[model samples]
Target: MLGIGVVASILGIAAGLLIDWFPVAASEEAKPIDTLWDVLIIASVPVFVGVSVVVLFSVVKFRMRPGEEELDGPPIHGNTKLEVVWTAIPAILLVGLCTYAFIVLTDVEKAQANTMEVRVVGEQFAWTFFYPGEDGKEISATELHLPIDRPVKFTLQAKDVLHDFWIPAFRMKKDAVPGINVTYRVTPNRLGEYPIVCAELCGLGHATMRATAVVQTEADFASWLEEAAKPPAPPAGGGGGDNGKGLFTSNGCGGCHTLADAGTNATVGPNLDEVLAGKDEAFIKTSIEDPSAEIANGYSDTMPKDYGQRLGADGVDALAKYLSEVTKEG
Candidate 1:
């Protein structure tokens, strides 16, 4: 039975190790994090299997017989040596795991020269990424873009409530506190796109508070940064289609909504083609200016409250009119 238990445990460990438990490891930190996770699984499997086997074997081998209702089982004294051995073993395992974890954390967060800084701001249901620009200015972007194989430091903050910045593929996460700035460093090793998830329960839109990070070659990243750093084009006459579209992108609306015309496919909010179907300009304006006044059937009241102030009356009306035209079904 002991031999069978050992074999089963080995098989279980092997199976667990073969499972792709996490997303693709796209950053340097992911190596140590994944290794630590595998080590934990290997160490835990034997203990779990041993305990389960012993309990089941004992229950079957020494359970009360059909006619032994009034009989009492023999009492056994506790073994001090066994107790000490179990306690010592667990203590040693815990200390080893903790030490390894700390080492990985330190290595990943170690500062490096020539690291670029990116400011990450978390609001109710959107993310705004700010990259350093020429002349000490900052370039704001709705999406995050980084150069592959380069160390990048992120300074995270929350505008309203607590939020967590997590990129599962990178195996790193940090909290974004309202009144505090938390920072972390990571080096993207692979060129790919990864989801940026809010691992904390921030508010009504907690589930939909999502974003993306794109890691590209150094040259492509530099080009993107240069383009993003350019000042916004002057508003067109009367704030209509083109002006409204620019406002929509500049204000970070594409981070949440699915608008085909705007090339935004985010699922955090209702699909504009469906939600704005047949709605008039006035109704669309109300929805944008005062989103909380009428919450969508499945969405939360997670829209930012300062849009009216940020975009002003003209911008809001233009956006409303633009959506009213673009989202109308034929």
Candidate 2:
């Protein structure tokens, strides 16, 4: 009966493991990582079942009957051989798993000669990607675009505080520590959009710290790189209104604040549409320049503090005016 139960448990667990447990395998690294995960599940389930069966069988077999309340159970001596076997088996299994994991990690992280580089910068609540362009210039973007099947290396730097760069589909993650640069490489095999998330808790806006990773065909990626490498357009409305919109998007405000005109729908902070509704230009300006001065109810002081310097007087004024105009009541 024990043997039959063990077999049933193993079969059941194996069936369960067949279910898709990860996002699509979109990278070369995904195959090995996934294989290791399956091995773990298969090995672990049997151990779990074996222990459960022993405990349950012992409970039922040694259970006291109604008429045996005064009886003393027989004492059993510990088996040194059994103890040694259990300990040695687990130790060997653990060493084997670790060794296999190390090999997988090593193989996945191997660098290629022609690997492209992208500088990833993580700040309070946003991710900025910089790619090498023509004439030693780097083009900056808020979204990450990668060519499918091309090995790309990410050089991560934190502007302030610690953050983590993680792409679930690619199954690669690395830390972004302040005053330090960390690097990780991945070769995307799937052509689709994926979310770039900060895996570490950095600050109030950490939850809202999100960005898009677009895996594109080589042709599309080349076109995007060409366009992005050009100089930016002039601010719309001539007063920097359009520039304000660009700033809002590039600076990562859309990741947390909801703004109708900008099409941002994040709820990590108070919705900018509602927060700015009926609010005056001065209030909106103050909010952007000194967000922590009067934080909206139910929102924390997660807004970046250096926007005033970063945007400059003209840009801040333009953003304030844009917000006021777009969010004003009819």
Best by TM-score: 2
**How accurate locally, in lDDT, is each candidate?**
0.82, 0.82
Runs in model 2 deviating more than 4 A are 63-78, 202-207, 232-242, 277-280, 295-306, 309-315, 328-330
Give the clashing pairs for model 1: none
Error of 2 at 116 (Å): 0.5
What 10-residue stretch in candidate 1 is worst by lDDT?
Answer: 233-242
Please list the residue runs of candidate 1 whose C-alpha ends up more than 4 Å from where it truly belongs after superposition: 75-77, 201-208, 233-258, 263-271, 274-280, 292-318, 328-330
Q: Could you give the C-alpha RMSD of every candidate to the true structure, in order shown?
A: 4.4, 4.2
Error of 1 at 284 (Å): 2.7
Among residues 3 or more apart in sequence or in different chains, the pairs in candidate 2 whose N, CA or C atoms overlap within 3 Å are none
Model 2's lDDT to the true fold? 0.82
